[model samples]
Target: MLRYPAVEISKGPRTVPWGTPEVTLDVSDVESCTTTFWVRSAKKQFIHRLKRREREESEDSNEDDYVPYIPIKQRKKLKVRQAEKRLGRIGLLKEQEAGSTSEGTSEGGNEGEEDEGVNLGPKSKFSLLDQHSDLKRKAEARKETAREKILKEEEKILESVAEKKALMAVSELAKGIEYTDPIKTGWRAPGYILKKSEHEHEKVRKKYHILVEGEDKPAPLTAFREMKFPKPILHGLKKKGIQHPTPIQIQGIPAVLSGRDMIGIAFTGSGKTLVFTLPIIMFCLEQEKRLPFINNEGPYGLIICPSRELAKQTNEIIAEFCGYLEKDGFPPLRSALCIGGLPLNPQLEIIKRGVHIIVATPGRLMLMLEKKMFVLDICRYLVLDEADRMIDMGFEEDVRTIFSYFKGQRQTLLFSATMPKKIQNFARSALVKPVTVNVGRAGAASLDVIQEVEYVKQEAKIVYILECLQKTAPPVLVFAEKKQDVDAIHEYLLLKGVEAVAIHGGKDQEERTQSIDQFRKGDKDVLVATDVASKGLDFPDIKHVINYDMPEDIENYVHRIGRTGRCGKTGTATTFVNNGNDETVLLDLKHLLIEAKQKVPPFLAAKELENEKYLNIGGEAGCSYCGGLGHRIAECPKLEALQSKQVAGIGRRDYLANSSADY
Candidate 1:
């Protein structure tokens, strides 16, 4: 029997009557507690001893009548916890032991457990793990597969969710606003709405495309706003009203920023300058913040352009970008131009003052190094702009000598309008695992340039050019094959009162730079130049490029035409190919014109048509049977035998006739 405790409350009669008015009750006992009352009890079953242990050794199980009770909190003991931890460790050890079983042994265990932290034992069944990989590979493999599947599913679900959320949010925002889409309204369903999965798939695709030979097409950048350059660089770009990066700049910038050696192959004026300069500025900014002060004893970065003007132009762009960066926390990146035309004393003083970057021509930079004006020990970034042109300018040995000072630590970026075997070998020796970006075909002109070919006598080119200039706008670039021709053309143009100047290798460096400045500033209407001004001179106003004399190579022709049609502006390129030695050039020009969708010349077609089915035999013997300079129809031995037989038959018939007459 079980007893229960209860409380009893007793109230005495009230002093005042309840029926009458104004009656008060004597409830002093209301606050009192009385413990005396009848108790309620229930019959309880009790087993004096606890339930017998149901151990295998002693089985006195009374499980039916027994009930188990537990406190909300668990009881802990050091020995029990130690035992549990030891058990866990033992379990892990067992897993490892199972994995480490010899391949020859037949130890059977789970294949799903982790196999690590164990040396292979002769007893383990999977001793060598397929005999290919080490101990961690199997676990890593399983984890990798599982992680890949999970990530794939997660990416799909997350993309779909995010896209739906974004689209629905846009729809919500547009509810109060007027929106009219001819394709998305009423019965029409756009691809983004109808085929939602297609749009969902591209969110996780790669950001960069691989450009390799035979598959050399790189997609264009649709917007510069999406690239999200830093504030300083964006400020510079905005000040210049540059809203988009050219195709080469789009791909080339990221590669350079990733700290990889690069070989950039793009057409001239395709914004290759910004490809190296932007990254160089950013690098300088980072180093500036990292170090207490920049050491100007030698430049941290070096830019080796082929010409003084290219170096000067690059230096000006760097200064512009650095000016924008100065407003922010970063100190402006100081740059100095050390080209040949400039005074060596000024350059030496600039080096003494210290510079973050030195933009110099190869020849001048080599001389500075020989004079010990600056050191290359701290210089970590080197840029070779117009690399192929530098090689052509006979700076190959100078470049190699300068690179010897770099000591394999510097990052070398080689940018060129063309890729020659020399550039290839130089890159192999200088750059370390470089990423090559060839935007268009190397040694090819921009499609933005409209090309026209005029076949005429070399002496009458001045007349043809005069006519072309009269028809076209000002600031035309005229390329001559020889310096004499350039001078003659310039003289004739001046005599005719055409505002023109000439530039070539024959001109002093100062004169060349001055002429280019005049051309760039529009002070001169026409600039007669050789291949010297054919590359990397950024004159935004050049509307026409006339090749007064055909170049020996199509590469030079491409560079000549590239002087115009810069940065998406349409311009014209006219080439004068004379009849004598220009036939070969015309042959290439015709194919190039046709390929680029330009107008093909009738003379090129007529010449090719005349020689299409026949080879020029000249005076050389080609075929002995027909005495033809070229191969005639194949000689047939069977036909010759048939002819001999016919002649013998005729002789036999005549002999028979004579014998009959004699008889």
Candidate 2:
């Protein structure tokens, strides 16, 4: 490096060395270096130096960049303190001068300006101590906030660890499940019925286990014959292959015959409607036989369904069933279907005609009740078909209001595939000390029906569904959330050469009926629908139930799948999922499957149910056992011993608790 003059640096104002390297600097009237220099060598050197000086000045300027300047108020205080320091020095100098002058004057006794009381300059003083105190306080506050944040992070970590441990425990317990003795089911697969038999119903009360203690009661056929039902009615039922009574008709007929308050829990397609309908028709016929009025207004029975589709279906079925009874000589059973979509005027006219059995939705029933369009005061029998679905969809209030119109101990028959707690509560409140009749397994996934749910990403849903339709080649029932989604999916399939039609709440009643009819007739192989199709639509060959969007609860899933594999047909349900959407609900579903001891998917084992080994799965919540989301423990086979430990503890606890407690 070339030798250069030593340059001194200071943070505060300080004197630069003179006479060593100062080329005259013109601060007052400085000109450009090119214009001010006289000698070329000196000018060249000066120009070079000027450039170097600029570089050096920039270097120094960056030094203070990190340190923010004090605010104007602080700067003013600093200046005031500096001024006071200067004034003190000046006063000291003046005092010395005054003493010297006095001595020189030999007692002249004249003090110059009377010393001005040693004036401290400026208006205020700056306290370095106070500034330091403020800085320390700020630092302490920042430290406290940081500490709190650390504690929260630790808490989150601890919670995550606890969840992991719990999941591991569930996983271990799942491994010991043995799957054998598979029952070969039939072609017509029905939904889950109550687990208890007539004798057992009185014993088990939890989780939808209804009991019907079958007595040596008069058979429904004997009752029909004794009541004088004609050969035409008996022949139609016989020709339709009526032998022994269905459990519902067996249990329900007697209760309704007794004219007492009753709640019957029967399986779907188990002649649930006829349980109450046959009795109502017989009773109405009996009333007609006794009264024999030319024209009378009566709503002897009210059957409530959750959906317009179900309402219409029930009405049609009842009409057919009762037609046989009518021709056999029960006063012709006139019925009106009260559901949304068809003009209410038609329903009103039918109601005005004095129908015996009114099949309606909760909302429509409430509206008819408010208009006083029908008389329900004389309604002796009340039936809530699919009562579980009604409560799930927030229709309890409306159902209760309908009940409010009817008085006197009424025979209420509640039929649902699965009974949730809410449904049980409703039965308790609405029905008198009723006989609980459970026909099959409580909360059992359909045994005869083979159920499979395919998890797919939302974005890939359309293609995945198309692939299934292409591969499976069976009548597919696709479900979407929105009416718009229904149209979109329908159009997409149509474009792909698949005959698909959309059905949703937005579709006019006729259009929905037509769409469903078209599918049923095999005119369309695939039908896209909303929750309206989730219940009470019987398509014998619905080979697949595609959930383009997952439902929020397990009950809906069960019902959706129940649409297919009906009459013993194996059905598959494909569900499209996205992150954060279906996790908890999927967990609930997995719990359902595990509780049922169904087969677990292998992917769930290696990925989902393992610690730190979760499948960003194809769907939501990591499995409770395997840490995999959107699948059951059986599906998550790989989550091993760690998960099992916690499970053993829980099992022991439950066993001890249940065994020790007195019922």
Candidate 3:
């Protein structure tokens, strides 16, 4: 023990004492005391006291309000000091433990005295290793609990899905409709009627280019007698001068009669209407013979046409065949024609009288259905004539809405001269397991038609139309792009004393009907019209079709020229082109001519060399969409417009607005 010195302390404001009045120091010897106490200066002691006061004040204040700035190097130095301090404390504890163990064995009494002065906290008995192991065990238990929770949720979801499926199956069964796999059980062709050798069927299909896609397709019948039709139906066929079935009728009729959905694609006027007409008549006749339909309960078969004129024409064909059935002592099979621009009361009266077959356009038929005028309760046979034209006329939505009203499954038949990919996709979704019957290419021009292109000036086209008509005899058809053009051409031809009659969408239903009847009866030499007459109109002995101006779309061009060459009869089509027309349409026309093996004009042929790279890329001749040889599917304008319309949320428009008047 050592005593330093006694100092007097003052409590004045300016003068403050350093410590108490007496100072005591403890040391084993004076040498150690001098070395330890003399090493620290007064200035160092004063600075350490000031730093202690600053640390205490900072901790007592709110730390969030202000943070003291520290340089990067100073911060690093402070961290190093803290680490060293921690290591030093740990080393000191280790050294004390080692010394205590060694000294306790040698001097037990002295160790006991030293242990009495030491103090241990409450957690001194717990080892760090034991605490770490306990924490890890708890974490593993939490993970196992979470995994079990997730597994239970997934199992619940699966059970619910299976339950829903079972309920749906039960509901379908209660309705007496079991939905089978369309691929497996859809084919219903009679195997006994097929030929023995498959190669014989292949040869017939190859000769006619009749491509059929589906499972278990029916073999084509070469003669009408092999179809095993009723005598009355056969007599009707004989009356119409029928000898053999066309390629479409050969494949399409069997597929439809076997209760399979079918898509029939062929050139214009290859007897497409007869394919569906005969089957519907047979269906109606069967229904009538089994049990005659009472009032408001029949119309077991329906035919949906795109245009009024086509519907009227189809109704006439059905009426003629029905007449033959009645003459042969069969039940009276009545048919009704429902279309726009006509008296609704007369149509409704015919429907109320219990017709067997109803031919209707989308606008009028949809109106009747929406107003609860009639229902397709027993109508199991459905036919869509000119399906592509209906889509172009924007009846796609109405057709879908009509489909929703059906109570049960029905045999669907779609007949069109052209089948684009979009419509084909729609058919796939709409009809279950449909058989595709294609004669030649989908949009290819009729092989029987002779295409002639002339580069007539804008001012001289009207004058040149007379010269073109002179190439063929009377009963010629003239198509123009606009109703104004149709009117102009009709006046010019009448002024020249050509006995021409005009018809367009602007005309009344009665006037249009009269004009068509006059032209069919040979009372008018030429029938001038817009595109409304270009599709699904059958005119007998039409020797020449003259296009006063080129149509906008290549598909329209194909339909326009198809009027002349029909029913395997050869005819001529003369189109007038000029520089004012679109380049894309002109290019497509040029390629169409080349594909048909017709003469290409000098102006169109000149650009063939420049587009050589784009030609023959896929080794295919024409476009699969519109049958245009000038461009591939990537650059198709029709596809682009359709996609844009879809993106803009403008689906098919109303039929009356878009297509009723052909405006």
Candidate 4:
């Protein structure tokens, strides 16, 4: 029901002679009242007559009452508003005064020669023109400066709002975390202060005899057999020079070899693969002698990695360790690699045929499942390498989907460097009363790696990182928070004659593998990487891990540094800290450094450590002598005195004044 506004009409009927002399009538009806008009030219005549009466009455009134004049306040306000609108329209409000001075010449000149004495000579004209030009440039510069200042202020406000929102969300998450159950620790190291007793070392040596002694006497194939490996493998190990089982393998192997589902909580590069793989290979060998063929029964051992590069590297490791079993009278082991960015049909073909071990990323395996190519139901042993990373990559849904395909009872081994509450919860639900093997702190910082963090300004990050790199030698693995940043840093380093390669999720499997190989083969001096290479990468020669960009989540910081200092080899990790305002990273860094027995440099402990201080300069703080910020003389209250001193000492102003007078 749409409604219309009511309209009023007036009707008038003309009195006319009967019949033949009939006249046409114009209708006019107003407020249901009738009006009659008898004269011709009624409209004009009525209007004129009415106006005449009104005009006569108005003209008879006092002249002073009808005077036209505006109040001073009103007139001034109108003029100010007009000026403001003009400035606003031109977008020159911030530099209006300067702009007016720039255009010094007037639109029209006087014809009379009364002002001829004020005219300039040739040199003065040139000087005046230069002055006008300088003024114009200054005005333009001021406008740009004002606009940039406004934009920066707006950005600061927006960042503040976003930070508040993030804080609220984190607070809610923390509240939820409070209600969750903590993971129970099963195995414990002997003492409050961890020490290797002579007898304990002996027991460890015997138990891990494969590392120290070349003989394999049912003792778990230790992380590194001290018994020198074959010259080639030994040479590689000797180059790395790691000939011992790390804490993780020492504790984790026994649980894994005995067919127990275990959750290992240790630092990255602590030989976690051998913890599961050594036992799985041993188990596989034992199974292969009895059952020669596992047609449609595999992939008997499935290792799911978060990224393709990791999957490929893990596959290579499997091949390397399986090579060791060949000399031990084991059948030739067949393994297949399946990941994205590769031919799916070939991967399906490889899986369709028999495969003892299948290493794959979550996405490709899910696609393979849709085609009915292979099933995880036949998988007897499952390993989620770098489980934290898998979860971090938003592959939880995909991982859960893959688990649905496995119906039979299977052993699940979950490994992660730093297990947050989320990963622990996933492990608790995913594993069947799993035996938890925590070699170091269950959920604490690694004791092996020497973690170092330096606070720097946002703009100073590149220079700081460059300076830090220049201080150190080669074999530094730099971790960036973004792929584009990795590419950028990689390019910049290359331009500066520092050999480097970039690796990220965007790279193809081959490119990623090649980049890792280059980093490993000493072909590239620096490797700039995103989080893709942060997990499960066993690069032993990594002397320094530089967090070129801080991780968004603090836990990623732990994993990025985990790349170096593995297997009793000491390594240093340095994180660039521009995110000092970030409560999580700042607090975590403080807590970690303090707990690790490292001196928290007073500079790092401060909330906002200025980059200028690191460069040996006073930053934004006002000077004690002049009470001036940003500049000593320009913004100082005693600028006149400073100018006098400068003029007397350097005579720059006197020279300028003399030039002005001469001109």
Off by over 4 Å in 2: 1-210, 213-234, 237-260, 266-271, 292-296, 470-474, 568-570, 576-581, 595-597, 605-663
Better of 2 and 4 by lDDT: 4
Residue 554 error, candidate 2, Å: 0.3
Better of 2 and 3 by lDDT: 3
* Candidate 1 collision pairs: 100-124, 101-124, 101-125, 102-123, 102-124, 102-125
List the candidate numbers ranked by TM-score, top first: 3, 1, 2, 4
lDDT string for model 1 (100-208, tens) is 5343221222333222122233435434556446546777877667645644553453343221211111332345332221111012222333344533322311332
lDDT of 2 by residue, 1-663 (tens): 222344322213554332354434443322322343242344345468768988888979898764544557655644654565567764664455445522232111223433122223221132678657856988988766765564455345334423121101122234533222221111111122222253443332322333554332222222344333446655766775665565555545555665545556544345565566666666666656776423337677788887777788778877886788666556677778877666777776766666777888766677667877776767766788777656534455566667667644456677777664334544555454455555664334565455455556777888777787764675889987667788889999899998888877656678888988899899998998887787767777777778888665555666777787654356665566555454455554555555446554543333333322332222323333222234433343223332564467542211011111101
List TM-score per model, in order: 0.59, 0.56, 0.69, 0.56
RMSD of each: 35.4, 23.8, 19.3, 29.6
What is the lDDT, from 0 to 100, of the residue 121 in candidate 4?
25
List candidate 3 stretches off by more than 4 Å. 1-178, 181-192, 609-612, 615-625, 639-663
User: Candidate 2, which ten residues in sequence have the lowest lDDT sum?
Assistant: 654-663
Error in Å for residue 629 of model 1: 28
In order, what lDDT does every prediction score? 0.61, 0.57, 0.73, 0.59
Window of ten residues with lowest summed lDDT in model 3:
161-170
Best by TM-score: 3
Task: Give me the displacement of residue 610 in model 4, in angstroms.
Answer: 23
Candidate 4, superposed: residue stretches over 4 Å from native:
1-243, 294-297, 579-581, 607-663
**Model 1 RMSD to the real structure?**
35.4
